[model samples]
Target: MNATKYIILLLLLPLLFGCSNDGINNNNRYLPNYGFSVDINMELPLYTNLQFTGNPVYIDQAGVGITGIFVMNTGGGYVAYEATCPNQEISECSGMFLQGITAICPCDEAEYNLFNGQSTEKEFPLKQYRVEVVNPSVIRVFN
Candidate 1:
């Protein structure tokens, strides 16, 4: 059409289509379709009749911006929780610790039960990553 009309269209093109590399859908929202995975090797003492305690290992998934993994023995089994705080959405918040079957957040005193991933004092629970026990010495955490 006219040169003036073409110029106007060009100026609005960037706004019409989002400026980010993430693809924009029909609803004018950017969607992130891809994520990352991490495999961590955790060394725990082999269960024996003489040994009653096992060492806890922390795994940091750097690709996903994870600071650390909080691993603790629950007497019956092992429980793992992410170090990030769900309330503040910060990776540097105080980590979680095992209290009975629950994981307590040191930042806001939010306690989450490791048994079912439910909060005891607060309504929101800690964000939990998927953990797969590969063997006696390996565990993989994934989104």
Candidate 2:
């Protein structure tokens, strides 16, 4: 009788704590894993505008997904974001445009702050890449 009681308690321990699907159900796995490296030479004509603060540029490079990427200078540092709308399903209209310090999605008017990748109207923020300043005039964006 004692052995049976101990066995039942061991089996019931897991049920008492319960289980949650919160972490196991991460939805980001559904999103494609697109990775690329972009080197921005601020001295170049195409990226010269990025040398100044509050300026942004869009680049369509390989591995950047359907919308490419948006890079900006925030006066203090450089930031890069995937130019796709986080709220909408992947489509042609899901591309986002840089408007000052915000990235706007024309499809549904979804806005995301470039400074921190926070979406103003949605729970999921824009996907961001790692930016590294290789030198005074060069910056690298990578996944």
Candidate 3:
């Protein structure tokens, strides 16, 4: 009500909203924030298989994703997902395997659709990275 009281209230206002999760990216907690990014050059031997549609390519490189990065061309576009199980923390068994059209988590046998990163048995879907076609010959995946 008074000038002193208003000053104190204003000073404390920002503190009340500081140091919180903000809740926008709450799902990143499930896996370590190792970062997911890769540039797929279709002409390279390692990524030559990815030039086709519906073929899933699993890259087990370190520091790319939690377990690794799984990428595929869904006929519509390219998509990438973190290779760890979305429902749990990163563990020895939390790394998923690429099946025909799904990523199967060995920890709990949770099956996630690779097309849209959805799973019926888990509350969270697979963590997807952003895909950008850099050129006709290359595409970059990142989060």
Error (Å) of candidate 3 at residue 29 is: 3.4
Model 3 stretches with alpha carbons more than 4 Å out? 1-28
Superposition error at 1 for model 3 (Å):
24
Residue 6, model 2, lDDT: 100
The order by descending TM-score is: 3, 2, 1
Show where candidate 2 strays beyond 4 Å.
1-30
Q: The CA-based lDDT of model 2 is what? A: 0.79
Per-candidate Cα lDDT values, in order, are 0.51, 0.79, 0.82
The C-alpha RMSD of each candidate to the native structure, in angstroms, is: 11.0, 8.2, 5.5
The residue-by-residue lDDT of candidate 1 on 13-119, one tens digit each, is 98998655322121211111224455554433432211123334445546542555555444565555565554554545555565555556777878766544566
**Better structure of 2 and 3 per lDDT:** 3
Clashing pairs in 1: none
Tens-digit per-residue lDDT, 22-113, candidate 3: 22242656875565567888898888878888788898876787778889999898888888888887788988998888899999999999
- The candidate 1 region of ten consecutive residues with least summed lDDT is 24-33
